[model samples]
Target: MTGVSLGFIPEPLLVALDHILPSRRLPSTVFDSRKFRQIKASIEEIGLIEPLSVTAMDQATGNYVLLDGHVRLLVMQNLGLVDAVCLVATDDESYTYNNRLNRLSTIQEHIMICRAVDRGISPERLAKALAIDITSILKKLSLLKGICTEAAELLGDRQFSSDLSRVLRKMKPTRQVECVELMVAANNVTVAYAEALLVATPVARLVEGKKPARLAGISPEQMARMESEMGNLQAQYRLVEQTYGQDVLNLVLAKGYLAKLLENESVTRHLQQHYPDLLTEFGVVVETVSLDRRHFAETT
Candidate 1:
């Protein structure tokens, strides 16, 4: 059968079962047919009142290929349904269309924004189009090129705080949860402070052998109750970049100094006067000098 072009789908259409999947190029992974069978059973039982999305492809091997509705097409195949009606398109067009600009959740939005930026979408243009903070636009877009989707989701959650972005950026994905735990448990802490250590060290030095101490006054038994909260994301989560977190990296760096300066009484006092409740604001302190006097003199 000869294929033709269909545009701006006012309605969803179907393509033949065989032609729907990527024939010569099956994705390395795909939605399992067993899952589709369940969907098919439900849809078939109810009648496919909602049309499945598809793009008809004309290829040398066969007549058509399905772009987006692999599951429905597979289900239909199992049900011995063929000759499905579909809007036609080429393989390349669907590639962009399937993954193109669209609304997403904060996390999903991050993924999309990242993809757009990677494709050379300007930060200024993206921010203007999205009606969001350019910094935020860049941060969301940074997820694709900077942090793993797993860690990005963690940062995007409002409760998680922008500080985690520093941690996620500086620490290796393998070390992220450990860093997060250290972040929460440390007496003096902030996203920025934790981020500095993450950038500087692989893991914070937690006391070995679990003796004579507790985190945040929580007993060991109580701490164990929320074990999952401190757990790493599922392994399927891909964190590709070394420079994963950058949005609030400045705070992270500033806190590094703050944490250091607080170690001395004189410096802490200076910080308190200049920064105002510096300890609470920074979760640490700052010193007037570049470094500790003893260390500075020794280095010089």
Candidate 2:
């Protein structure tokens, strides 16, 4: 199929609020949601950074259909706004904007906050605009102060907690990168994981050359064992990272082949008659992308 162009002339226009009809219904509890409150606060503070997307209803009707920004429009209506700056879409399709939405990652959010501060936005004002505390704004401003470049890049698009950055700052750059790689491989960036990584870090890899404090009920020997195992895990994680893309491609091809093989009438009958157990396992794999039951199926 050929690609079709979308959007109206690629320019923003000032539209009367009455002309735009919202296509989606806002939940009654939306005003109580933290996200909605933030949207309202941000609009009140900065006056709508992202314009609503709309498409002209008719050539002579002087009306438009709201394609995106349902929440923004609701907030504006509550605020008694008479007009809005909107992007007039050429096509009426709103799926791309509504369903394929991408929120800013932790690092991207940090960068944006830094940019805004550099442009003379005060921490207090920014905090109010985001409906967050002033301390949170300060924490975000200093989020990447001690993170290694490689690890920062690895986590740039991940929605990890900012507190993890604080935990990472205690490790040496090399160990930080290793822990980050392990986290990425496991697809977990929780503070608990970061704390575990910190605990397993060798004293030499610590920024101040001091060992992590031992947890209650855990002896030094156990910590030593954990550090050793963590080192081995890092080695294995690096090996997997080296061929991750190729491994995924192979897995996909194998699954597709297996699915096709199981689709054949003869093979299905043979399996059902002579290898019912194996057939059940194969059916599960064909239906799901999980690697959970086989040797590759274990959780991190």
Candidate 3:
């Protein structure tokens, strides 16, 4: 940071805080009332030790730009204080002030770091100041790198990066977005389950006989577990197949994922590819997208 010696002239008047602060200095869809309430109460009781920073707009406008401490200034203004001390800080200096140390990130925190860079802060500089590994920072940025605006809209604090990464990792951008729509339409977003559905749905449609898989109303975790258990069964069967051949294992351990899969033609190939050794230890999941579509088609 550059050492600065700048003088402050304190002159403040009541102005709409919203007008004074331009667009958000950060990417925030949610303004936490609980945190703000606590902060407001604390400032009202103890008084503001750190002064707010502001800049003059112009000679005629009688407006000032708040560079930092918007929350504290708003609290004071709401309390009917006519004027409070404000320091003059350049917008450049304003970005670096009072940011806390980073711990493991919540989704929002990671988003903000990218937003900061998108606003023209250098990634190297921003990463250093944020005290995060640059590689991880870049990896998270890659999550939305080529995601269509349509698909990216489906992403948010909880699963934005993760979900986008999952789909984009496997398919073309157009297909990635299509997958994202299904994910949101189902009100769910996670990598494995989304991928499973993406692969499962179309195949189920194309298969000639029997109905498609039932994909909806199932959480990613459940699908993952089902796959895991099915994997164990496959391993057992494979051992049996090796010792006694397919005829014996098919007799005892056969009526699980494979039976269910064989019952449907469309997603059978997908199950074979993504989950080899269906009942072995590789795990397999019944293709749900196909099943649900079939159920709907039949009911109709």
Candidate 4:
């Protein structure tokens, strides 16, 4: 068996800030951004949590090229830091360092906070370290308190508010999963959409089997109508989902056939003379990219 190759040195090296050269220049506006301010505050409060990633030192100048953590580097410079720890990469390719990066999702943040708290970190300390309010940290800590495992897993990578989870908590586990699936499918995972789903939910599907409170302008009749319509919409969506793969396959085959047919001069002339509209439509199907055609099929 072959050993797996490592990108960075196992041990981090302490390097002077002056000797670390940034691979790319950041925009001037970035210095004034909220993200920059948060990082600066976090470092000021607790110190840098993640070390910078840098390429191996150049023998000529004894300088290391920074592969990642530009914001942290700038923050350290602003804070008058002289020396910092950096992981030295085996190669100078910054693209691999950045391209593989994953932003923290809401659930991932929750898990991190929970882990830190379990390690005896207080909410106040966490808030200061994250440069957010203590309430926000507490909210993240309890983000999945009432969420079912299936729904939470479905929304694991999604960034949504605690209020959305609260809304989900009002429904039974099955309803929660359904609502989450609907919201994710529509790409509208906002609290508003979640609330709309909650409103349309049948009373039996609610957590306590209680009816949802009516909105100011919506009466019982209106809510009932919405419930029926939403159920129909969900059914239609699932039906489409079931057939989407086969539909795309059929369209691909049809497009390929039409493309080859259009290549023949005789067939093209026959369509152009007697059925110009049909020829134009055929040309569209033959020329349209798969993604655009898929979108058209879904919309129609």
Which model scores highest in TM-score? 2
Per-residue lDDT, model 1, residue 153, is 42
- Evaluated with lDDT, which candidate comes out highest? 4
Which tens-of-lDDT digit does each residue in 162-184 have in candidate 3?
44474454555555655665565
- Candidate 4, which segments miss by more than 4 Å at Cα? 1-14, 24-33, 87-100, 211-217, 259-274, 286-289, 292-300
Output the better candidate (2/4) by TM-score. 2
Model 2 scores a C-alpha lDDT of 0.85
What TM-score do all the candidates reach, one by one?
A: 0.27, 0.85, 0.30, 0.81
Using lDDT as the measure, name the better of candidate 1 and candidate 3: 3
Ranking by TM-score, best first? Answer: 2, 4, 3, 1
The per-candidate count of clashes, in order, stands at 5, 4, 21, 0
Error of 4 at 16 (Å): 2.8
Clashing pairs in 2: 7-90, 8-90, 291-297, 292-297
Q: Over the stretch 212-275, how does candidate 1's per-residue lDDT look in tens digits?
A: 2223465555455433334332221223123334623654577576676667899768867787
Write the residue-wise lDDT of candidate 4 on 1-300 in tens digits: 999888889999999999999989999999899899899888887788888999999999999999989999999998999989898998767663765456788899899889989999898988987878898998899899888999999998888887898899999998899899999888888999999898898888898777655555677798799899989988998899899899979888999899899999999999999999999999888777566777876644
Off by over 4 Å in 2: 1-9, 25-36, 94-96, 212-217, 288-300
**Prediction RMSDs, each to the true structure:** 21.9, 4.1, 22.6, 4.4
Candidate 1 backbone clash number? 5
lDDT of 4: 0.88
Q: What lDDT, from 0 to 1, does candidate 1 have?
A: 0.50
- The total number of steric clashes, by the backbone 3 Å criterion, in model 2 comes to 4
On residues 1-300, what C-alpha lDDT tens digit does candidate 2 reach at each position? 999675455678889899988877778999899988999999898798888888766678878888889889999999999999988777667553654346779999999999999999999999999899999999999999999999999998899888999899999998889899888878888999999989888888999888655454667798799999998998887788789789878877778888889889999999999999999998887666544335354321
